[model samples]
Target chain A: MKKFLNDPVNFVDEMLEGIYAAHPMVTYVNDDLRCLVTAKPKAGKVGLTTGGGSGHLPTFLGFVGDGMLDGAAVGGVFQSPSAEQMYQVTKAVDQGVGVLYIYGNYSGDIINFDMAAELADLDGIAVKQVVGNDDVASSIVGEEHKRRGVAGIFFIYKAAGAAAAEGLSLDEVARIADKARMKTRTMGVALSSCVVPEIGHATFSIGEDEMEIGMGIHGEPGISRKKLGAADAVVDEMMERIFNETDYKSGDDVAVLINGLGGTPLEELYILFRRVRQLLDARGVNLKHVWIGEFATSMEMAGASISILHLDEELDRLMAAPANTPFFKHVTG
Target chain B: MKKFLNDPVNFVDEMLEGIYAAHPMVTYVNDDLRCLVTAKPKAGKVGLTTGGGSGHLPTFLGFVGDGMLDGAAVGGVFQSPSAEQMYQVTKAVDQGVGVLYIYGNYSGDIINFDMAAELADLDGIAVKQVVGNDDVASSIVGEEHKRRGVAGIFFIYKAAGAAAAEGLSLDEVARIADKARMKTRTMGVALSSCVVPEIGHATFSIGEDEMEIGMGIHGEPGISRKKLGAADAVVDEMMERIFNETDYKSGDDVAVLINGLGGTPLEELYILFRRVRQLLDARGVNLKHVWIGEFATSMEMAGASISILHLDEELDRLMAAPANTPFFKHVTG
Candidate 1:
């Protein structure tokens, strides 16, 4: 478990310092809070805030920019940002229009961010909360609504970012983010586990020749552990489950994301997306857009996840909107 | 040397197939050639083209989007795209506004891409070429103009893509891309060598306690190899050389990119970037913008690089422009 750090405890602090040093256009609320605010806040646009555990480079923080998130509350590695931290970020990033609290659905994250949102409201800040529950692997067959949030949170970011970039109000931003979340579903698998730098050990274990099906981003055990299989088969199982959980139909336009869970190769993700595309094509699903790479990561775990979103005209337009942050940008069109 | 592939020979083909399946909006020129074109190519906009080996995922392919590149010509893993392949891509992507050829500088890449540009011009398709030579490690101190191109090519894509997206003519886009090359410089080090899937072995050699400085992205050995040192010390040596070789001044505004070669963790890139910022700040250098991640990968090697660019007003505007590709997007005001 070799790493490039002097002390494990200094990891987050040093990382944030470097991020700030590299990007002088962003402001840090405080060391204790671990909140980042835009250097130049938009006067009337709804402020967007998101945060979670660290290690998923570019997920919450990477998406911060003009159109994405105005602020991000960062926690420890694979740990939730504190309630106080989220509150500070909300206040710092908020404009007269208000702020949107978008985040994943982990128990710790939900409790903390929920508390932050309440606190913001008491402080005379209009803050709306939206929890992304798009992970099909975290729910039972009949409990799709209970799914946890995973990489699918990226779509929420895109939607919220686009809306806010368009100068939407807090209500409009929340609505678009929630709508994007409803249309999105994701599932991940881990072929190998990762070592947390702070802990200096593997978070979980997997046999060299075996893989865990529907693994969570933090290396949490999935519904089943199975032998590593062919790319097509893996994609089929993952996409089929996601497809079954979502109300996708033939001729329905959608955007697909094949994400590397930190350590997986782009080669593998592309392969997974290929199989996913084939399956969708067989079902007569119309694929309108696709993204493949490490959008959301979990340390250095060799795994990948698939996210499918049935798109509407609004979502599609938002998808094409411009965004610029340290780790992401969507300005092509 | 573990990899996920059925056969070595099928690596590139399968990867291409998988990309096509994932994004229906992207279609390749030929079933055999890895020249990916946008599903909807805009008319009257100067077409942008970039291509390189497969290992640098998102570099050549991940960048094909509306404001970015129109098409990408992919070669084998760490191999150069053939002249004919580039020629085919130019023809397929050209919208009657001419084509801009932007690629990295390596012997094979230069030869092949140059040949392609010549062919395109001979066919009466206005073609412009700009070779990226930004790797400060490969150049002599007194002759900085002879530097090689490494991971800094990603910036080239963004700047050029933004210009083309704004409907810049081929000549103007070429000039901007060339200016970006002049402003950029990169230097990389390897803690571990990368293994090409097809070779089933590493492309270079490194001991458990050794490191290579000034290595090429193809796993080629660096100019020197020595015992590994602390992150700060290692970065200091790299940055001093890079800074000394360029026109960057203490108060000059610059863009910093700390790119992981492939297998290194984001945690490490942070540590390295921390030291890098400190060194730059101590010298009175101002970092206007920064990006740290696996933007340009080289298989799954455990290494990283530092890229610095002196941003002029035009370069800054171009750098701040929006880009929409699979891996990167930047929408700006």
Candidate 2:
């Protein structure tokens, strides 16, 4: 594995230490550095909390800033954080209003976050949850809750965070979060596998000339592994799955997010974005907002994921609203 | 190659087209999609234009937007753009206040940009150029003018772009760019080589357990090729070269930019940044600002470069000013 690390055991902790040293906008809430909360947390606003595995940068922790998550319980690479850690974050970030949890729809995350919600309820902290199930390739239609949440969780964050920032009640924020979760869909194609630091080797392997369509971030099996072909062909397959799986129809508006899975270059993401826009245009789906970069990523995995958020006026406005984070920032509302 | 491209020959143009379809803020000039200019160009302000080879995504063209470059003449991957292209960009963005040129220092770039400067001169437009030579590993201490430019050119961009946005004259903006260019220093390491899409093979090679310290973006030789070491060790070697080769004294305030060449993970970049901050703290250097990401890259090369900009009050303020680009965006000064 060509990774820069000290002790494999300290990979997650050291990465957290690095984040603490790099930005003044974030700080740990307790002795457990894994329990991170935003330093600029807004008072009297409903708290936004998100957490999951660690390899996906700017996803779980990096989004903790203005107009986003107020607290994030960081996990080890591809491993869920503990219920105790999540409870710590919820208690720390909650300021009488309540805390809303938004995280990916993975069994490990669901169990931990649900347990954390129970623990928080015992502490008089009102907790509501909105789980993301955006990766359509992970499950069949009508079984959307079984799908894995990928980069499309970012849309849920935007909707819910903006709602909380607007001083909405926990139910209102959860409503918007669920709306975003329902509207967004994602599909990924991995050209190469990523290594877990502790493992110090690739968790999975594939032929040098092959790519796996709809690969999970943790090297889980994708729908198909085939010889890599033209960019347009790959995007067409992805768009077909997303369109067939989601409720999007003609004349609908969308915010397209082309996420680079770690090792993919920005040039390639734009190349992928080009086809996505064309595909959307041909389908009479209006591309209203475009974000083309690495919002969510695996660790040094060569791939790109296409995430489309079907946008209504409220979601479009909230997502377009100014957001500031170490990784994602938009100045204009 | 597992690169997501249709025709390797159309790599640059397709990436440009993708950019055009994605963001309405940038549009090309004169049917040559290579000549990109900001759609939100500020009239009466000194126009900042930068250009060079493509593949380094945010490096050359992606910087063209509000508070950054007004125009950029793009080139094929790892190749300098033509003098005609630069001249076209200069002429189009010359808003009566004259234009300032800032780009990397290389024989190909200097030759082309200088020729373009002459062409602009004949057109009665004042053109001032700041060629960045900030790579500390490229030359001896006193012979800094012979060094190669890398990611440190971004400091020059932030300074000069802010100065121009402040309505400074071309000369004043160029002066600030020069100051930033002089104070900044960078050093890099390559874990693997990158492929130019059209070339269809790796431009250079290294062993699995090897890393080349101070390697140039286009596979230029570095100071050492030793066994791949820990992140701290790699950073120590890089920091030694930067400090030993520059005039940084104790108690200096500087901004740090740990830029992934292309393929390195954000986690590794942060791990490297942790050591960087520790070293700077030990040396009594105050780390005023921190930027850690892929600001410049070598298409999927596995490596990273560390750039430090020593700041005076004016440069500190200008560098900290809000600048918006498709790649680089800062909402706060």
Candidate 3:
């Protein structure tokens, strides 16, 4: 495999060491290297925590900072963090208020986080959980809750983190997070598969001239694979799936994110955003905010995803709230 | 070519359209589709304008926002923007104070920007220029002016933009920009070449097991091409060259940037940064700030560059100044 790595066996440890060395605002919680906590945690506020596999950056760790996640449990590439790691992070970040865990709706994450919550309960530290299920391509129309979580976790993190920063109770923060997840929809198109470091090869094979619509972040089988078409046409298919899954209406205010799956450049993300804007305008969907970059990604995967969040007044305000992290920073106007 | 594009001929125009559509804080100049200007220009402040080939994002266009560049003139992929385009952006951003032009030290860019400065001078708008020559591998010792600029343009933008935002005069801002450029040093390695959309093929070729050290952003020949080594060994070679070129002292404070050339994953970047931090620590060079991401990219090239800026007190404050752009946001403490 052509990768900038020393050894596949040490990839996770080296990456975590690098992350800790690079970011001064965050540090390991106690002796548990798997859990990273913000250095300056706000008092009398609900502690927000998230965890998942390592490949999707700016998801769990990148979101750990002021006005966002208070801590994160990082696992190996595409592998979920253990329940013990999550439990330690929960105990470390709880500032007498409580802690809320927000993560993607993957079976591994759900199982681990639930176990962590139960463990935390024994210590009298209240812990709430919200599993993001915004990937519309993962399930049928009436089974939105069964869908896999994707880039829409960004919206959930922003909304729930804002609520927590406002000193909301753990339950209230969880409610807002759940609301954000329900309103957000995402669909992805993969031009190529990503190689896991340990695997040393692509998780799946795709032809040069072919593309998979509705592919999961972990290379799960998508709705269909077809001849790769123009940028606008591929975006159109993704958008149609999202619209059909969500209750998007004319004149509704929304936030849009055109996310790159690692290998894609910002130039292509903007190209894809242009088509997204054109289609949304025709449908009378007002874009209140638009983010175009790699918020979450599969390691070196060449593709993109579109995520739309139907914003209410509260959601709009929360989305606009200030956040300062390694990967994301939003200053309040 | 496997790319997410529509018509190769219209790639630049379409990308600009997408940028203007996605960012509400920036708008195209009147009658100049290639020029992007901030919607709300701070009056009396020296206008900061930057431009170059279109492929390196967050370098030019992504730096145009509040507390950053007042305007950007975008060009075709790996092709410099015309003199007329730069002239138009200069005219749009100048607010009677003056304008400072900061761009990479490339033949086409220097020629075009110089022409535009002359044109602006005819219209009574004072224009000062600072050509970035931070790529240490591009030239020999005492010939820094002949070196090409790479990821170090990011430091130039932050320092000069901060100076201008502080209401410094044109000459002062230009002086600060020049100082930033002089203090910055960068070295890059490339595992693969980037493809220009119109070219429909890689700009250069290398063997699967080979890597090019000190390669330019636009596929210029590097110092050497050899068998790819481990990540730490590669980083050590790059850092040794940087230390040899610059007089980095034991107690000197420096800002570090590990920039991905579009296709490298964040995991690898941090892994690289881990070694960079170790080398600097052993040398006793204090790292005051660190940034790791795709700052200046070559479309979708799979590699990375290291930039080190030896910072004094003034440079430190300016680097920490508040700036809010799509790709970069530094919140003042």
- For candidate 2, lDDT tens digit of each residue in B1-333? 889999888888889889999888889888899999998878899989899999898898888877778999999998999999999999999998899999998899899999999999999999999999988888888998899999999898888888888899988999999999989999999998898998889988899999998889889999889999989988998998888866667888898899999999999999999999999999889898889999889999999999999999998888778988888898782
lDDT tens digits, residue span B146-169, model 3: 999899999999999999999999
Model 1 Cα shift for residue A190 (angstroms): 1.3
Provide the overall lDDT of each model, using Cα atoms, as 2-decimal numbers. 0.81, 0.90, 0.90
Q: Could you report the DockQ of all the candidates, in the order they appear?
A: 0.42, 0.85, 0.79
- What DockQ class does candidate 1 belong to? acceptable
Off by over 4 Å in 3: none
Q: Give the candidates in order of DockQ, highest first.
A: 2, 3, 1
Candidates in descending lDDT order: 2, 3, 1
Candidate 1 residues B1-333, lDDT tens each? 345565678788888888777655578876654878888799898998988889877677877876788888899988888998999999999998899888887778888988888999888899888888887777786676566678898878778888887888888999989888888888899887777877877777788778888988877657789887777788888987887767667787888888987777776798899998888788887776677888788877778999888888877887876565556655455
The parts of candidate 2 lying over 4 Å away from their true place are: none
lDDT of 3 by residue, A1-333 (tens): 668999988898898899899887899876877789998888898999999999988776998887789999999999999999999999989998889889998999999999999999999999888888888888998887789999989999999988998888988898899899889999998988898999999899999799998899999989999998889888888888888766768989999989999988789898999999999999999998888899889999999999999999999999989988888888876
- For candidate 2, give the DockQ: 0.85
Interface RMSD of 3: 1.0
Quality of model 3 by C-alpha lDDT = 0.90
> lDDT tens digits, residues A189-282, model 2?
9999898998888878889889999999788898999999999999999999988866777989999899999998899998899899889888
In terms of DockQ, which candidate is stronger, 1 or 3?
Answer: 3
Q: What tier of docking accuracy does candidate 2 attain?
A: high
